[model samples]
Target: FKNAGFYRTVRKNNQPNNNFKIEVIQGGLFSDEEIKKHPGIRHETTQETGIKHLDGTISMARNEPGTASTEFFICIGNQPELDFGGKRNADGQGFAAFGKVIKGMDVVRKIQQLPDENQYLKEPVRIISMNIR
Candidate 1:
């Protein structure tokens, strides 16, 4: 992963509205390329998943309809505008909701309360490791 960090609680006009996300680099960090060398998975919004951007919901981040890499986010509030047919983006194809926080919502809220500037955490919360048990 090229980047893995929590989003700032404050929102900027030009920033993508999200709570936290881990950016997965397509190519290794050493290569000086912005996009991936090989074509990655292009998940198009064929149909609505019927998932809403409610609090604690986890979803994939994508610029276009498809082209979702390993980047993802966790919502801290009821972001209904991020749903399909919502006006968050011009395309109207909102992010893909895949999961939610089943426990430890207090930790997520604490992370969201961190200090930040321009949607970037002033003192980033380091994640040593994430164990999925």
Candidate 2:
């Protein structure tokens, strides 16, 4: 759905100046009623390789309590602050990570360093296409 714009950036409820450019690994299923029920579906120990708990690592986005969908991102750098209960998840929970970039490190960096004056891209990132394997 992200590729088709079904979902929008996970903007902070109150902080109107902060948002992340996360990647949606599998997007279409997000609108599916049954799938939304499983929030912990794509997460594992944050120590896994490629999907390690590093910055620039792409992962799944979820609601505060754990409502994951097909959306994910490549952490531009090490962001333990976004880890479970870190600054980003001050509520004592955090976003679920599902995958990482096997390629495209440059793209991730570019997106991360973008002029996020409002904490979100003035021109938001858009997915061109998606595939499943």
Candidate 3:
């Protein structure tokens, strides 16, 4: 629900052509222990829901397959590798995709561009509030 960190744009080797390169952009959420400690928090993984990680998709962040707590991430690009059976993780369960950005993608991109050292944002962005409609 808030900006915890951002993934720096890095050049990855093109699989088809070793000499070619592609940029991969990614980002992460700010975890709040207070939120995680809330009595209402659910530590379970819930159903798979068969969702895929497309651009702007919001998904729960987990260390293992079923350990997602309050952390989450928003896809800055089509991250099929983060979807179920994705290659991004060894377990291959992938992150739980739940929501998509309806607007303000520019703001998201701007935040993604913030300076980062070793993949950690130099200045972590904060979420003052969140509302559900």
Candidate 4:
């Protein structure tokens, strides 16, 4: 997990109190090619974990419309919109969340406040630490 990329994200969740931190490990954030072969693997993994919405912590990845690679985000809020809205899979289903942040939330807030261009952060936030559970 030490080598994985870290991202600070803001969620467009329905709740005003929605916002938090998340960390992606298993080297998932560093390769789009790797994810192409196992589409929706993250979503499946989340269901098995039985944890949805770190409450405030959020996670990010490329939008479901295409292949998601080295970019990931943290939940700044509860993003129900991401869960539904006719946003289906190949068969038409909603996207699924994979993981959450267990610590380092202050880092997320700092990253989100960084300057951005066209909404994408001008500079990618750095990962302070990552650990496998």
Candidate 5:
């Protein structure tokens, strides 16, 4: 997902009950066409890992247990609420955190500042290439 387009970017929580304030830039599930073209692939949700979704952290986005595949998000700030038992999801089974940004956080914040409508970016900021080390 190094070059995937960001689909969702939110500053805070406005949803009822699910008000676990968070800032994130989610990508991987682009558009309907993209979904149709590359149907969402499912893989086992790896658990028991004690990774936390801190600022610049990268984690998989899922609906439920074992529902994550390609969808992932970058936490704009320390998002402990996205860890195990987080209230953002009804299941409280937070996302599967895997990695983090070692540099270029300024770019991540810039992406967070991009105009968004109801949590979705008006115009996605896509990376042409990303180096992972």
Candidate 6:
């Protein structure tokens, strides 16, 4: 995901229908054009990885407990409602949290502040490139 991902959508505490202070920005090949560019990929949800959704947490974005894929999000604040048994989802299945932001939090926060309509960013942030040590 280092080079194949882009900052996609975002959810803040102000969004309607939200009951908790949830703030997250989802990322991946969301657009159809982008999805076609990166084809034949797989990510199994399996189960909810137990980890409190604190600031800077990175996790997989899924509709159901078994449908996780390449899409991921970064937590902005201590979003406990995203945890298992939380109110974010009705099924009690939380997101698949695997890591946290080691750096570039300033950049992440800036993404959250971008203009969005119904949680979708107006100008999607492009991932120039990335490398893992």
Best by TM-score: 5
Candidate 2 per-residue C-alpha lDDT over 35-124 given as tens digits, one digit per residue, 9 for 90 to 100: 555455644435433344475455666654445655455465566655664556546455565555666767655655555443445556
Instruction: Give the per-residue Cα lDDT of candidate 2 at 30.
Output: 43
Task: List candidate 3 stretches off by more than 4 Å.
Answer: 1-47
Give the TM-score comparing model 5 with the true structure, all chains together.
Answer: 0.81
Candidate 3 accuracy as TM-score: 0.69
* Backbone clash total, candidate 5: 0
Instruction: Answer with 5 or 6, whichever has the higher TM-score.
Output: 5
In model 5, the worst 10-residue window by lDDT is 38-47
Better candidate by TM-score, 1 or 6: 6
lDDT digits (tens) for residues 65-90 of candidate 6? 65666677889988777777677888
Q: Pairing residues by index, what is the TM-score of model 1?
A: 0.68
TM-score of each: 0.68, 0.56, 0.69, 0.54, 0.81, 0.78
TM-score order, best first, reads 5, 6, 3, 1, 2, 4
Lowest summed lDDT window (length 10), candidate 4: 18-27
Total clashing residue pairs per candidate?
0, 15, 1, 16, 0, 0
Greater-TM-score candidate between 1 and 2: 1
lDDT tens string, model 4, 1-133? Answer: 3345443333232224424222221123554555554555343323444445444334335555334444455555454434434222332333345566777666666666665543445666555566646
| Pairs clashing within candidate 5 | none
Identify the superior model by TM-score, candidate 2 or candidate 6: 6
Every model: Cα RMSD to truth: 6.0, 5.9, 5.5, 6.7, 2.8, 3.5
Candidate 2: list runs displaced more than 4 Å.
1-51, 130-133
For lDDT, the strongest prediction is: 5
**lDDT of candidate 2 at residue 98, scale 0 to 100:** 56
Instruction: Look at candidate 6 and give me any clashing residue pairs.
Output: none
- Please say which candidate is ahead in TM-score: 2 or 4: 2
| TM-score-better candidate, 3 vs 6 | 6
Report the poorest 10 consecutive residues by lDDT, candidate 6: 39-48
What's the lDDT for all of these models?
Answer: 0.58, 0.49, 0.58, 0.44, 0.75, 0.71
Give the per-residue lDDT digits (tens) of candidate 3, residues 66-112: 46656667777777777666666677667777778788778777876
